[model samples]
Target: MASYGGVAVSGGMPRFSDTLINGGVILEPWAGIRAYASYAEGYTVPDVGRIARAVGTAGVDIDDYVNIEPIVSNNREIGVELKRGPLDASAAYFWSTSKNGSLLVQTAIGAPFEIQRQRVEIEGLELNLSVKTPLPGLTLSTGYAHLIGRTDGSANGIDVVDRDLDGANISPDRLNIAASYVQGSLSARIQTQFFLSRQFERTPNAYPALYRFDGYDTTDISLRYQTGFGALSLSAQNIFDSFYIDYYSQTVRPNDNAHYFAGRGRNFTLSWDYRF
Candidate 1:
């Protein structure tokens, strides 16, 4: 096992600082069962260019811009897995907190510039399971994730509100599922996704602050063929060509007719790969 920590400084800026520590232990108190755990912590300062972009103003002299304090994030995660015969499963949880988190604040002119005083917190849990059945050449795998986010000292001090909706954007819940079948040199896969109902902030002057959207569902399919020399693959996205809007923001001006940017329709791609 090995662990390390160090610090250094260069240029006219402050010295760099970081600390990392990790160790793993394998336990086999019984046959066919295993357990392990590891932990780590690290830190780093922000980039000079990012700092400049966050505080610099348009049409102003670069020399006039001032440097803001560097931001930092602390992250942690832990996971465990179990396996027995053809079945295997694992679960993990992660969380992160930022001091002076960086974010982009939209200007009155409709462009997003950077801001650093904001703070952010994110937490999530994930699980994965897979099984191989007695049936010859058959396998099944599935996974899911749940995430939550919050911001502190926002423009309106509203916690748990969708920051993406600040400009009248809407955030929706998402679900995804996929499966694949394999035989010989050919394989096929199919996937589907669903988005729950969302409400967008309309052009403040023309309509109310919110516009509800009907949820939409979409599916995709793909097939691939492998030869001795190369492999050919093709896929179609949004195969159902379901018409829906992925994102929308309130226009700066209420009377502006072009307030929404439409989402894409059905799309396709094909490619071939060869190895020497």
Candidate 2:
């Protein structure tokens, strides 16, 4: 990816390019068990002058601007799966670390700029399970993930937490479940996701607090008819059109006065596909 654009807040011109390569391998050493691992590397150009100028406007004082260096990261993960009869389960652990990490730092003046001197580390675990029963048209699937991140190096004469240390904006834990049923040409499915409240550190004296939002549950039903000319189907999303905030950002004042991004209300679609 390459971008040639000027900073909106600052008048400085910015340019960047990145190349990424990722690959993985899988091996089966025994019955009902398989293992896999993968790695990826990324190289990118940095615009240090643009970043410095932005940060300077944010109330930081710097005598000179320095060009940023390329950023790099290394990631590795291993996992195994087990299958038996009508049930299957899998789990994996992953760790990733980055050097010369590029991040936008905000200064007291509220100016934000990119910096490539920072380092970051992240680790996570994931688990998935699926079961199919003999009972006609019955299938269930569920999964969970937990992630933690932190800075690998010190910054601004303070020990910053590796993960969004300045704020509580990290998506740490997630749970999801999905089930589907089919009878002849008719099918129905229900899926729901739950995200734990996120914690943010508002002040040095005060501990982080979790902001809560109602969990999400959505159901979709669809029917398709087979025809000589084509096939037509209809579907609906968010059938209930639950009223809730999908996302939000905090304000300087510790109040919930932040604007909320609304989720999709009730929506329907009809699709047709034909083969010549």
Candidate 3:
């Protein structure tokens, strides 16, 4: 239930309607654990083609553009779970808060983008694991993720701006490991990924080396073959072809140099699935 604003049809703009209130709850005392909690409501608006090409004022009339509203959010979560036999695990934590939040200030490569309107906060963490390897059908898995954000640029109240939340809008904590196998009909999979390296602590903002994010690692392989009349698949991605430069093309670096891209060296895919 969401309805955003700003529409033009003999209208002056500014409309908002919401009927949100998410929910969650789970419990299992002990016997293998399980616990949870949750709440949510969200919205986002303002990207009308990057605010109509960064509005340079010519015929501006989207209700006079008063910070282009809508950025309402409030989310929370907590989790825990663990299965007994063959092991399986989980953990989750989440947080979000927003009040008019919007930021995309990166002007100076070809300029045109300075939209700061703030009061934002985000936090996240996730962990998962699974194991069931007595070799009968093999399975092993691992996962990890983390995120942090900050912003209090003060549009009305709170002021303690440390800014931070770049890397093209957060994303630089990663780890994943996987292995799976299924005999009969032939199936195989292998995966690996780890991208963790970030640094921040250089006030006086404004493209401080794009907020320093440099970390990379990757591996992937997959194979499948089934008989009678269908299924044949093979996949290989980044198979040790690690070149770096991600996190939103190195901090959304505006223009030129094709936005500095360089990550993609090995790739292969083959598929044929037919069953009719």
Query: For this target, which candidate reaches the highest lDDT against the unseen true structure?
Result: 3
Worst 10 residues of 3 by lDDT: 1-10
Local accuracy of candidate 1 as per-residue lDDT tens digits, 99-168: 4555544444434444545566666777777777676445666666655555553456644333323333
Query: How high is each candidate's TM-score?
Result: 0.67, 0.67, 0.38
Ten contiguous residues with the weakest lDDT in model 2: 1-10
Task: Give each model's clash number.
Answer: 0, 6, 0
RMSD of each: 9.4, 6.3, 19.1
Question: After superposing candidate 3, which stretches have Cα over 4 Å from the reference?
Answer: 1-28, 36-77, 91-93, 98-105, 110-117, 123-127, 136-139, 142-166, 172-177, 180-237, 240-245, 264-276
Candidate 2 root-mean-square deviation in Å: 6.3
Please write out the lDDT profile of model 2 over residues 8-97, one tens digit for every residue.
333334445677779999998988889999998866656655554444233333322333546678888999998978889999999877
Candidate 3 per-residue lDDT, tens place, 153-248, comes to: 534465655666766567789999999999999999898898888765334355465556778888999999998899999999988888887666
CA lDDT scores, all candidates in order = 0.57, 0.62, 0.76
